[model samples]
Target: MTTPHPTHLRIHQLAGLKPGPKLLVTGAVHGNETAGVAGIERVLKQFDAGELTLLCGTLTMIPIVNPLAHRLQRREGERNLNRNLRPAPIPQDFEDRIANQLCPWLAHADVLLDLHSFNNPGPAFAMMGPRDNDSDLEPFRHEKAEAALAACVGTGRIVEGWLSTYALGLQRRAARQGDGSRQASLVQDPHYGVGTTEYMRSQGGYCITLECGQHVDPQGPEVAYKAILRTLTLLGMIAPGAVELADPNRPIEVLQLYEVIDREHADDQFAREWASFDEVSEGQLIGTRHDGKPVHAPSGGRIVFPNNKAQPGQEWFYLARPSDRKLKP
Candidate 1:
């Protein structure tokens, strides 16, 4: 077996007002999208400079989760680190070890904010967990979540898939338990299921993802600043006066997006001039086949994560979000 790369996990403790809720804020899970790095850095500075107070809980931040990727300025390591987490019997990679450690830590938190960014030039938004475990009747919980998201990063669009995937992972783990205690208990442990969010949820922690904005946009820094303020307010970690929104959050549509996987050989190549969230027309050329051929989209709206570096039988899956514009046809 090959040895995994060593990834050092750094922790920053923001000595809040005595004992308080713990919040885990991570950014740059993907090396290429680094808007969160700036946001996190700024937050740490503010906390240190006495600009923001940790009203109730701990604020822990990991600015860059993918250190190697950041160093390489690429999305994934040569090893597809993102897919190496969980259910692997043995985590045979550096990423897995980090996940194993991080998952457990995440479960202990009162709340978690997984900071991320897209490769596209678009508005920012938030992604929530699929299960509405918090009482549905509470307007503040749901509205606060939506408003927090809308206020932050400013993109009103919300994604339903990541949370759903997390919940499903949890449910699967629960169903596989032979013992009643282990079975029922794991789901409550926060790190029971498959995802970072699943682990957070099992630990009874409220977790959400903040996708800042366009990877290379300089404006991304400013956007992330806004998001951090809104998140702090929405979580009730700060006073309402601490967060003064420039304007009311805009209306955003909830999207049920889907993915298209790619299965191609290494030698066979396709051009990837397409950008993430780039609009696509039906039957438009998407890429080339593994055997040096072209592949076209049978159904399309947006082309997400278009890439030529994808491995064979691995997800070259492209995400498609329904267009906001009215259909011409």
Candidate 2:
């Protein structure tokens, strides 16, 4: 096994023959979301002719960023590995230390693809900036950006909002609405933000996020692998049409990444088996704290990814707004 140092987190790289641009792909920033790791593993194993050509740029692949989280099969370091990217106190927690080293690499990329999986059964989708989200990929880059996102996602469901606002803002002049010509979904806040992908865009790079599917699902990792292959194909980093792909259009919904409920202690218990996208009744008891206190839903909505093996302080469950299925967005 190769040791991953801060300077070289890249597990593999197929530098292009013609140095045009750099396309970086990362996986397993979150330990439990093993889909990216598995996806990259398959890509590495399937070495064919012209698998990753430096046709236009260099390709770098980092399979695991948070080994600690992977070791425990949980999200890493008390703080989410995606956040805490700002210039912070030099000496801090494990994630911060890693961020201090990694954030720069993410920010410095020319084009980056950060792979992740969700707790819920999710359609493969692309997560981008707020219409107001600032990014280095802003201005003249909207068309290509949208096209890139569109090509990566089998579904049309794209994410925008606070993620673009907070982390995405770090890259550009400041994401203000009614500016760019591209009519992207102007989201104020979606669920997750300040993640590594957002941070990369902040540093003047083209970065996109891919949610492969439910993390624990056996096919989840394979789906992510397909995503990686497709994305590289779109970027012209590999042979065109290298693999057959899934073309599925999903309804677009702004995912407001809510707070995570963890189930570390044995005392934590769910009221019932919650399914992904299950409709919920307001004030219904979703689960109980380790102390046996009732945890209820605040409103009538859908339950997103509901994890049963969350670490004591990590996210165990999440809330989501289900599509009415009547109104088309």
Candidate 3:
């Protein structure tokens, strides 16, 4: 809070009349995802304009977490700020400096909403922290709590297992013929593990990342705005009756990100223009590899986060499967 105006890690706070849970909402970890930034700005303005009242908790908003990258209109500045959130002995880059400053806030908050957007056109979805099997953690340890928090975000579609999916992708890449050296180099890349929301969960706090549709979609900001309101109500930070929550009986689609397809060869290309959430049949043609080999869907599932412009050796898309789980909260 002592940081001067225009600091990259800008923070705004509102204290309630009574002490309660501390909530931190962060936006633009990736600089190009500006909807969350705009949404957080609007939320703060509402607080200042007396349109929204804080009842019993602290609300802190960091509208732009990675200001330098955001200013550059890129996904990152020197590096992807989302990954490797652990403390560094010395700040190495722009994101590192930002992380060192922001991690404390993440550690102290009872709840966190890390806002983001996808590169491909897609409906809004919420990404929750890893479950027991998702990480090396004990079985079923964080699943219930993480699912509960994710459900409150009202995205209707909740995803888990991002870390697991990324790990599997790396493993597959490591198995490619004559690619061992490249695999070793890629594994050493800092953006390989838990991101912001997952890091918060590691600290015993609940966090959810809201992907508010495509980067440039106008609805993306509206999705983020409603998500924040819903989360505030669910956490009792805002009056329950003041804001409408999602219908309890409303159908919710739960998914586990199972596989991440990589564009391992330069000539790899998607078979067609595929948007996120597009369902594909088993054995359906998803794309083609550099060797003129066809890549078919291994199973019938919905494809999420499909990126036509993915670089070779990077994730081009992910396949998600349906889950029958219900949240207790």
Candidate 4:
């Protein structure tokens, strides 16, 4: 774990005269995903320039959640902050400390937008985790309403079942290593989404993680900016035409995540530089195992979050398929 710089986490807030939904937007939870932070800055500039106005409720933005990591141009400082979002009696690491501090405000918000960017180049999408009837998501107990609200951001792509993938990945890893702690944790709270958005959802708020695009994509920041504005309009915090909707008929492409592939040994390697959303056929050779055996696709699907730099015991990529479910604008 690297020592973080002694910088204070800052939250920018804007309040309107009329009361409405409280919206929380977080950027740079993973420091490498900088576009979100830039997007927040751009939006703030618009507000200061009188180009955008808050008609009701409040807007809170945390431009850089992991400042030290951001400064170092790395993904994280100590550990993945997004993974340690669950409340614990004592903070476990640097990210845990920040999560604990942010918990109260997260619980109070009516909605949350967690901004992020993927390592593998791809189109922008909005990710929503599973929330069962018994889950802690209070106002968003209905999945249909949640899907509609998420699609309102106009990202045009929606990802589902991340929690299941996370659990499946962990289960396979644990099974191979004969470990049980992660499995135990999953059993204890199956709904825990393992990210900032998931933490917000657990606190009875509607939270969406908008993956703008590849980390350094030029269009990433602008996409994030538009998403925030669209969200404000959707929440009725601003006039309908305050921000021109980019796509009048944005059709959300819903994907069901089913598998997460992990690099279990140093010798395991991907066969090619696969980008996110790259489609693969059944039995397609995707990589090579530690013993030089070929690794093939289990089914026909698209690969996402593929990493050429994956480490042993870490996720290398995920597999998903398009589903009939969609939210049409």
Candidate that scores best on lDDT: 3
Q: TM-score of model 4 relative to the true fold?
A: 0.89
Per-model TM-score, in order, reads 0.71, 0.68, 0.88, 0.89
lDDT, candidate 1, residue 16? 64
Clashes of each: 11, 10, 0, 0
Pick by TM-score: 1 or 3, better one: 3
lDDT of each: 0.60, 0.62, 0.79, 0.78
Error of 4 at 148 (Å): 2.6
Rank by lDDT (best first) = 3, 4, 2, 1
Task: Evaluate residue 260 in candidate 2 and report its C-alpha lDDT on the 0 to 100 scale.
Answer: 41
lDDT of 2 by residue, 1-329 (tens): 73342333546877666766576778888878888898887887675443544466777778988766676677764456775455457645566566666766666568777888887565666665434243443322443563455456454454433342343333221233333421121121232345775566556676667777777778777777877777777767677776765453444554543334445466688888876657788899999887778899888766656877654433466665543222122
Q: After superposition, how far is residue 243 of candidate 1 from its true place, in Å?
A: 4.9
lDDT of 3 by residue, 27-137 (tens): 999999999998888888887898888999899899889888887788877677787776667876667788888888888888888999988877888887665563353
Cα RMSD to native, each candidate? Answer: 8.2, 9.3, 4.1, 3.3
**Pairs clashing within candidate 2:** 16-54, 17-54, 120-305, 171-202, 191-256, 191-257, 261-316, 264-312, 267-290, 268-290
Query: Which pairs of residues collide in candidate 3?
Result: none
Q: What TM-score does model 1 achieve against the real structure?
A: 0.71
